[model samples]
Target: MHLMSALLISLLLVSGCKSTTTRTGPIAVGPGVTQSQSPSPEAKRYTYNSDIYLDVAIPVFNPGFPIDDDTGHVDYQELDELDIWPQLRRAEAKRFAVETKQALAKTKAFGSVSVVPNANTSADLYVLGTILHSDSEFIRLEVTVVDSSGEPIDTEDFEHQVSESFFRDAMNQDKDPYEPVFVEVADYVYELLTDMSEQQKQQLKNTTLVRYAHYYAPDAFAGYLSQQLESKRGTQFYKYELNAMPAENDPMLQRIEVLRNQDMLFVDRLQDHFAVFQHTTNGPYRKWQRETLPEAVRAREARSERNTKAVIGALGFIAALALGNNSTSTSTAVAKTAGALGSAWLLKDAYQANENLRVASAVIDEMGQGLDLTLSPQVMEFNEQEVELTGTAAEQYEQWKAHLRKMYQLESSAN
Candidate 1:
């Protein structure tokens, strides 16, 4: 009978060890066994005879923190003015975009991969992405591909959990742990391009050039560059007609080409500013990750310990009740002691979990302050016009495009 009671206690304790706490709120790490490296799928690659320029737009930062149901979209303006945290998030998004561009460029999938400030920038393809969440242990992104006309081509969502081994490799290499995520994104884009029909590829090439010309000299190409739809019984139908293309040697087209080359020079110069921003933020960003990783690990372990103790306490109580009538006074006393000891462990676990969470939060807050020190307004000048390049690449591009339009108009009028 004593042996049976001992076995039962051992079984209960073993079962208790298997259970874990379900984390709630922002403290939750995604469910998975950490992989040393992600599996590489054999991706198909296509070689295009003609050049294809791809523009990667600066990603939007979406803080995945839950808010009240009554609160719709987050007012970023309010947050931007008041919160340093949001500013850090914005910096994270910019860094993410730059890394993605670099990844795409490395793939050699396109003739050129440029990090355009906005969607309005002309390219054969546009990659728009949003940073849903970013932290030391995990990163999530949603990406969409569209043409110059805002027509959706493809969309994909990606999430990656940074394993301890992977993190260590990244630290040793002096690289971002999330670099694999960007590589996957580039692969997805490459796959999409490879699967396109020849006709679709031609359409993409023509549309990109037409849009570039139209932006600078819309009046010259209006009739040749308009979207039209086919109608059946006075209703529009599936059939659509794209703009007609001008001769390759049209004088206005040739002029637009020269103008675009000059515009690209300006765009290339703008990249230096982005390079500076990246250099300024990269150190603090990586330092924050390296410093916070241990805290995250400790917090996870604390939660696990708390859960184990709670389960053991509950099981001990059950065992004590089951053995109450059959057991000797000595056995009863031992069972009671086990239950009491389990309860004490539960209290200790709770305290440790709370302390771990507090420490993790403090570490993140300190990192945010370090990032704030690196923040500064960036401005660039072109043709006597000063443009603020402090916001997302898209915002800065919009300002640059406006300046280009004015310059082009002035030159056209002068001629």
Candidate 2:
């Protein structure tokens, strides 16, 4: 009996233990979470005897929204309840992208790291990202890096969690709280590109024009690129490779390059879109995080303590039942009654803890409601005629590319 009782106590102790430093529990929407930093060692920039350095393009990330599979979109009330909205998510998509570009630029592993508006931008390398989760104290990203050859360099998840003190120090140090995570991502990319031979990189650059030309004129560029089937761990995938390179001074090739340069110029101009979004959203986002810090801390602490109390209460009731079954003494009866009452009280306290959680959530919800992120449209100049770029940023870029395709087809036919 004593051994059995000892085992129960040990189980309670083990189950009730909590870590104050970090947490990886599933984050419920509308609830506050925890945080910590992950600092990655910065490596020296990779250099080769050759002067060519691969240009990198990073498109805005895919902002995560819990979409309803049936409708293919999210509900507005659900957004409010989740403490997030479409505007915030869209802004964050660009926000994380520019921050990552900044981090990658500091590494100097590539010639230039640009936050391109087009996901299919003609660059030697692409670092694409998806936002899995982000909040006041934590963030997770699903990143995929590929070269023009369509070879996957790295496809992995990166996450970070931080505490209140981390935010306090971020202001003092004049750094963004999310900067460390982006820096870590950049370092990982630099290390991988270092292992790639210069010839391999040049190959990626070589295909840039072919890929861009194909985008504009698929039938004309056909047979210039081929796909190879690959199998790994019983999974099949395809990687693209250039079959032939057009002559540098070929009239048609020169025309395609001219079109590609025009497209690239348009893309370079869109950097201002990302830059403005970062500047506008940074202040409100940080302010929201700091304002909700207290509520988050209280909610987490309450949840931890509630779990511990519930566990102790369950163990007490079991022990009391065991003792009461063997004894009919007046003292034993009183002891059982008191043990049951204690358990009930603990249960009540657990309910109260949940109420505290609700209060914290409400506080965060109010803060979320008050957060308004303003957006500005981009102005684009084409043939000395300046026009306001309409539609979503992504939509505007896609429309511009479509217009470019028309121009290419008309010119090609005339030639």
Candidate 3:
């Protein structure tokens, strides 16, 4: 009876019977343990030649205590560094660019990605993203994909949490965390950027906004203006930020600088729009087609320059002849010298005016083409009259006047 009972107990234990007891042991991963290959990633990176972008715009991170602002306090002063916003943006932008390339390369799509400025007026597909909430340790983001005409194509929101200690440790070790952050964030962005739909592409082509900016400064000045774009160190400000400008004693010069900055900003904005436009089949304003205007302007300017030089020479000779002739009356000498000086100044002014006009015309022509605006002098005149005349308009009008002045000079010279 005892043996029978014992056998029955053993059988019950071996028969996979349910038990209220718990068991604990080390989990092992070894050969014969049929280890499962991690599931293939949803986004298989491959090289792609398709136009794609990864633009990153960072908000000012003031280092105030987290309690001061509803979102932890950040020091406002540190944000004021001249290059802070751009530097952050560059870092973020480059990270996205690299990661996008890597992801695309994985799929053998393309090995590289082109990075460009974001413009309001155009982008094949405008990717509306924000550095929603950022702290010293973590950043939260919301990325939305939209067609050029401001319609949502697709949307994605990502929350990235990182350990503050890890970052500090990496910093202490002189290690860069940029790659890690970039890889992660860019992966998220790429997942959205590449998975664009056919409908989105069509919308991008049909609705891309046309935009332009006209900078009427010398090349060197324009270059400087380009470099001084506003970065968010503390507040949003640019190198040429008119608000931070020194109180001016000379209103005219101040006004000129202000105008220059405004124009430069407009240029920057157009550039942003173009960057967005390039991703689409119908790119922002057909820049490739419009590039010919500069050559045309140069050719015309060269001829005007030659004429100006001749007129200047003639005036100089007239002055010299009057000065050398001892028999000439005092009145003759004075009159001749005045006339030469006046003519030389006038010609120089005219040449300068013509150059300005040419630039204005070129800019207008480009804008007209880019925006698909039908441009007739009559139309321009009408537009000029309809709008509230502001400083920029006045400046443009001056350029138009300069063109008229050039025409007058040509007609006068011909006669």
Model 3 Cα RMSD, 1 decimal: 32.8
Candidate 2: tens digits of C-alpha lDDT, residues 46-105: 454556788899988887767777898876666656655466566677888899999988
Hey, what RMSD does candidate 1 come out at?
Answer: 12.6
Q: Say which prediction, candidate 2 or candidate 3, comes out ahead on TM-score.
A: 2
Q: Which 10-residue window in model 1 sums to the lowest lDDT? A: 232-241
How does model 1 fare in lDDT? 0.67
lDDT for each of the candidates? 0.67, 0.75, 0.40
Per-residue alpha-carbon lDDT of candidate 3 for residues 1-415, written as tens digits (9 for 90 to 100): 9999999999899765657555686677777776444442464344444653322221112212223254565544544321123233323332333333343334432222323333222234443445443322334545554433333445555564444344233232433222344355456555565676645444343222111111222331232222244434233332221112123453333433444343344334333333343243123322322333343345346557757765775777676675657547787778777767776776776677566655644443344332311112222222123222223322433444344334433543575
TM-scores of the models, in the given order?
Answer: 0.66, 0.77, 0.28
Q: Tens digit of lDDT per residue, candidate 1, span 269-336? A: 65665677778888888887777767666656766776777677677667666677567788687877
Candidate 2 wrongly placed segments (more than 4 Å):
1-50, 67-87, 167-173, 228-238, 314-331, 369-388
Error of 1 at 34 (Å): 31
Candidate 3 matches the true fold with a TM-score of: 0.28
Task: Point out where model 3 deviates above 4 Å.
Answer: 1-44, 47-118, 165-185, 197-203, 209-415
